[model samples]
Target: MVTDRFNSLGRPARLVALCLLVVAVAFLVLGRWDLALAIGAGALLGWVLLKPVRITWAIFAVAFMVPVTIDLGYPTNPSYTLLLVLFVLAGWGRLHRAERDGWPPRRIGAALLLPFCAVLAGVLHWHGVKPVVVGVAPLLCIGVLGWHLIEEARRDPKLILRIAEVFTWVSVAVAALAKYQTLTGTWPLFDQFAYDWTYTSVFDPTRAAGFFGHPIVYGSFAMAMALVSLTIRGRYWYVPFTANLIGLVLSGTRSAWVGTALALGIWLLLNVRKIAWRGVATGVIITVVAFAAVAVNPSTFRIGTSEPPPTWVSPTEPGTKPSPSPSTSSVDSVGVAGARMSDPVGSASASARFERIAVAWDGITRDWSTVIFGNGPESSVRYLEDVGIGDGQAQVFDNTYLTIWHNFGLVGLLSLLGLLLALFWRSRSLAGRLIIVGFAAQIFFFDVWLWLSAVGVLLLAVALGAAEDRPWPTLPFLNGLRKRRPRAPETSDASTPGFAAAA
Candidate 1:
């Protein structure tokens, strides 16, 4: 009866049954039902679609689902969880032949691995392993997985458009949700200020964070999606494009705004001959109108929301913690008046970021050993406590470059710069180059690497931009920019009607 029932299953069904059976056995052995079930489900799906599923698709999927992290009473999110499952499935060779294809071109691979080597050296020198592990976990899960996707993109040029379409549509939904959250003052993952999100009024007016945990992250992501959506080529493409732009403005993150402008400007400059004048003019008109709308309502469109002042305990009197400082003095940012591109330096947030850099420089260069090898991964929290920079809660250095230098010293910083340079140099399309330069510029404003969603967006950008010397697809107008394939030497048979056209 069992044999007959097993025979009744079709080929695909039989494979799925076998996959589930294997997963069941593994689950019984591993014994973490939540993780096991999640991974098993992912693996089953991957195995079923093994013939068609590529690593690039998985990367894009992770990027799209960043707003939907499944909480399991831990700090973990969907980005890490999904990437972990992909990594495991890759290990089994049931998905992503990028492994067999030798993932991550050599120079990029070396750049990716240097930080881990530095971390290992630090751990051997008696630095805590837990912090390094925690800090590098995302690197292992997201960074390496992303590199594999990039390698895949390099191999399959057509896959870039597929990835971009998936990302663009999903980002439209994300932007819509951000708009909803901003207008309603409520959202599904609204745990930013404990039980209520209304406390944002204590600073500047509320900014839309979506499910990305922070307004800055949401803004940056929206900026990226907007840029990608520009490549979309339908009569209604502007709908998603405009949606992301609205999301970016509602986020009230000046850095992201600046990044978007910088990226667009750079891309335009790079492709001046390729793009049409009408498109640029239309875009400028739209952007100006959007800015004007925001400017008209400056009260609610404020950027640079102030954070609470750090509690001070005087060294002279060890027993007392002072009361909160003056309201004006307590403002951590330049408020609404200073929220323009003309005066980013005037903002208190920018000033604080500069101050952090100065402090980090002093700490990082205290000794030759620290300069060369770094204090350790995730040592910024300890450094912050030692230097009195808002206790250990202020983990990020507010500058990704600074964070890298602090965590891995000059070695790590140089390694990161090298990787960025490689990406920019290797990326053939204008879009890819813009993404690289834009990310490089934005890292100065905040710690771009601390968030998984942000990293996923970066990876997605890399994949779309990794097309080999081809003009980005989707825009028929850009077809003229594509390089003409060299023609084979003409023969007598070439003129014959019977000759099939080259694919």
Candidate 2:
């Protein structure tokens, strides 16, 4: 009877079973028995809660396979990775099957570039074989997941909102835990438990870095959650808003503050017409109340230091001597140190970035082949290392556009820019267009374009797939160019006669 039941199962089910078995075995071999158990539990949970979708499964498989790092010392948690894989699979699967048609080429094409770039890097032997391999794998996985999401959204617009909800709740839980840890001096559970420096804030409470390593990452994640919560309709919108706000306040990352505010502001301005004013008013009230409470209790609002000293104030200048008091002197010394840290070109971080960018540009210009095709993926790391800067220095590129230019040259840069432009042009709703614009703003200061955070990826994916108002096929470009569609006349019931009686 058991054998017969097994035989009755369809090919897809069998395939899934086999895949799970392989994953289990792989985990066991890697000595991650707990992760194997978690995977099994997750599989069961996913099956029960989410109807299995083929494209989702495929995308999940692709995403899972991409993180094949030979070194294994890359400081990633096996359980967290498993969770990410499971969620990506379940979420993408649910989305793909919910939609009517498959993913479009433009979307797929954009996603494919990540893996293609990785492959090109490998072939070019940039940053050695390991960096290329490591870099490409994650890109490949993220790309597959992205493609799956785009395809899924085409079927059900609501699915994205649902995914956003789940993501927000999880982030809230994480943020709450981080906050608890911050207040009590207890260690947080998971990999973040070891990141003790995150809690060493004197001015502000350390940023609540739930599952992510850094407070900045956590802040960025919370920002995304806040935006999602605001955009979607839900019974408990305040929950996400409150949680994300708390998380952001605790994170103490100025960049996160800027990014989140910009993103949220743009989202609101564009979609104000569609938004529920009552909800907006309530949120605003809650925020105001919270801010007041925090203001009264200054300790609650504090996170890290106020700011690093300006990098241009020279200690050698007249009347620049350090102060006598310890606190004052410390601040003064920091200022002097910051000034001394400036490069020969009088640029602090800004100058260093400009210098490096100029060098990269020069290198690209010197070779037309490099300019058109890029030196390959991970080439910038190797190039920087060759120029006396260590591998760590390669991370100093603050500008994503500059990084793209240095690593992929003009072609890669243009391709990425074009993708962004296309996505912006394709956006239909005001909210969608604004979200894309905000994301574009972020790329100028941060490298989130490639990061694998759920919030970041979700924001980018949603922005890319959002529906735009396109001209009807039957209408000519110039047809009714200035004519406005007549608004439907408002109707009133005679039985509701207060206004009628007054008239």
Candidate 3:
């Protein structure tokens, strides 16, 4: 009876469900956690209330807009909460539907191993397991989420474009916030939540962090929006696309710039035939003009100086002999020994990143167990402290690959690579391709998913993956091309008497 009720629930039932969800969210935000929980429970009890497709749309749209939470410091974004609710409704819908659900892709098992290993390593290393669990939980949820979204997409191929349009609007909202900060000299989202939102302007602040915690994260978010905008066509399309590009520039993160550049280039290459030649030429001309002007007068443009700053070394002790300055050849070296690749060449931040990598690499290679299984989840902090770097509480290897390499070693690295490849391989639709490219570009800058704001990004990819026409791919060795159905045989003219007589 319950299944039958939900199967045929009409507009009035959906309206009631919508009202209940709104109240539940309002109650939660107002700190009435009990009331929110009760209302949510009541909505569920009415089995016929929730509409799966409409709820799916709300989950994404709200997730992008409402990264807010009941508390600070926790993963307070409610996208995760909405996702769990959606999954419940989806399961119920499937049980009473005409078609049976299929099993998820094989690659998920391999992907899930990363978390399992994290938990096991935590137990063995004697570190508290809670942090490890929290760190990997979102990843695990998104893993299954991709499969479910793909299933939904198969039923309605248009969902991917609709989701892309949703993302374009989300990107515009965030970009407007970033621009507003420039005008008002205050960022409401961060300031409202009492976050230490840095980045005063293009000159004073380190970078424009926007609603997201870090400028790099915001850049990634903007880059995602830009890619989605380019892929989807509709009214006022250029607004969000241009806004996201401007926001990316304000982010001032080199890695994000590189990622966005690469994704944009790839998108252009993939759709070169369809792109307008005049627009491309105009973009090229404007870019050249901008570059030439910046080159002519760096000071006028407020860009960096032509001369490099002097290298910073610790002052010699009062009575001790001073060290000789290194020659020109050695100046290029960065990192701890002052000997890594040139990034900002002689700057402090560049030195810190490479030094963290060199130090992190050294810490993990000390023994076979440490090297193979890694020191455990979130174990990088302890190692950093042990190595005598700023009390080890703050300094971290921001590089995701390096961090995973240091934490989970070769196996983890390989598993991560496999997942990335699998996701790329399975992206059949153009929109899905754009989402994957945008997300992959951002991750090189930071573990963007670590923050609440980025959950929508991952969810978008999941939704895109859901809409992909390709079947769940196996190992990357197998080609991702979907097999075509055979064409029906054509009836000959002789088979039709009217046609034959006319001839």
Candidate 4:
């Protein structure tokens, strides 16, 4: 009976069955029997469909359905691995097709090197089993995904833009959910344990975590998306740009706000030549409308003045006694009630970021190895551990450039800078330049260099490089001037006395 059943199933059907079996096993291992059953059913249906495009789309959907972020008692999450896998699969397909066609290998070689470099960096930092499995592997995955998208999918700029749009929408939804949780005094959907560490809001009374582990991270992500949206020309472009801007403001992340503003400024400057008059008119209209709105509603977009609990309170401490709940009058006295607070234009947060930058610089200077090669991936945490700095109390290196230099050493830092410089120089269109500049602006105050948020922008920058019209400089040996023969001296049309005689 087993031999007959084996004979009944053809090779393709058997392959499908094997994949289904693997999915079932994975689901069983993860204790998700329902998901396993669904996958099993989907596999059978997908085989019946027999359309390659449909099957591919179904696989993509299933891959995305898998939750990338699972709590494994670690600060880092593996949610992004799913994206990396999808990109790798897509890249592999492209590569296989290219190989079959006997395409020139040099083009593919250049395309693959960036990701290889990133993988090399990851491998060099790999220490034990945990580091290899968790940190380095995940980073390599991201690098491969970035390279795949930039090199393969870049022919369709619209597709890349659509992905950015989707990410923006997702971020908005997450931010809204977070705000809802904050208002209802409920735990956030993600990062439940870190709820108390969130800053309290006064007027709005909400924390803004938009699908990210932290509010600031979400805000920075939104800001980058906003910049990208602004680069696109469309009727609905302003909607995302405005929403993302508002979301960033509500995030109460001072560094993000500053970074966004600076990025926007750079974007505006880059696009000024093309849209100078329209931009001026738009700016004037927005300013006038904003002033009118503020005049009519003084409380709109007011900054919160809620004071943080005393340092001794230990809000995030497990099993710590809660402080005595304050009365309404006490809350009122502390400026927590309906008192409108003026926005502190460039507040203490900005000052604190500057201080952190200085501290990171000082720390890097103290260690020669850190200054040269970087401490290694996520080495700042280890470095802090060596210096007896607790994770909770550790000072953040807010600047991405500083963070990169401190962690990856000079080689990694310069490689990143070179990549950025190449993108900037290669940017031909105004929109492309704006996108690159916007990302560059954020490097001063956020550890964006390591995050997928920045990686996406970097990938987009690389893709834009392909669309640029700039020509490669001629080599000294290949110069046209060097190849051209000297022209013979031209004779006068009307022969002069001596020349005519010689003629």
Please write out the lDDT profile of model 2 over residues 1-503, one tens digit for every residue: 96786678789977887799799989999999877876786676555444544433333232222222121332464323543564467455635454655446766678778567556635653456666665565555555555555555555555555555666677668666656645432333432223223222221222345555545556666666666566553668777777777676665544566667776665555445556878679868879854542233224355874533212222466544322111210122222223434443464445555666667677567676676666677666566666644332334455667666656666667766776676555543333444455556655655553344523444444533453222211122222542353433367442422211222
| lDDT agreement with native, every candidate | 0.60, 0.52, 0.57, 0.50
How do the residues 320-374 of candidate 4 rate in per-residue lDDT, one tens digit apiece?
Answer: 4343224211111112211222444354545566566666777677666657755
State every prediction's TM-score relative to the real structure.
Answer: 0.71, 0.61, 0.67, 0.62
Worst 10 residues of 1 by lDDT: 494-503
Candidate 1 has which clashing residue pairs, if any? none
Question: By TM-score, how accurate is candidate 1?
Answer: 0.71
Worst 10 residues of 3 by lDDT: 328-337
Task: List the candidate numbers ranked by TM-score, top first.
Answer: 1, 3, 4, 2
Q: Count the backbone clashes (under 3 Å) in each candidate.
A: 0, 12, 3, 6
Pairs that collide in candidate 4 are 68-79, 69-79, 373-408, 373-409, 374-408, 374-409
Cα lDDT tens digits, model 1, 1-503, are 98897788689878877877787778778886866666666564554445434444654564545443334433365445655655553343323464476543563465357557456536744566777766676566555655555556666777776666566676678776765654443444444432222212222334666667667777767877777667545346676677778777777788787888888776666557676888879788777755543334323445876444333223356533232223321211223324555577886677777778888888688788778777777778677756666632243578888777777788888878887776666665555666666677777778765466677667766666555354332233434433354444676444421101210
For residues 359-442, write the lDDT of model 3, one tens digit per residue.
Answer: 878867878877777777777766666665663223567677767766766667677777766666556545555666666666
Clashing pairs in 3: 149-466, 150-466, 200-205
Q: Supply the global lDDT for candidate 4.
A: 0.50
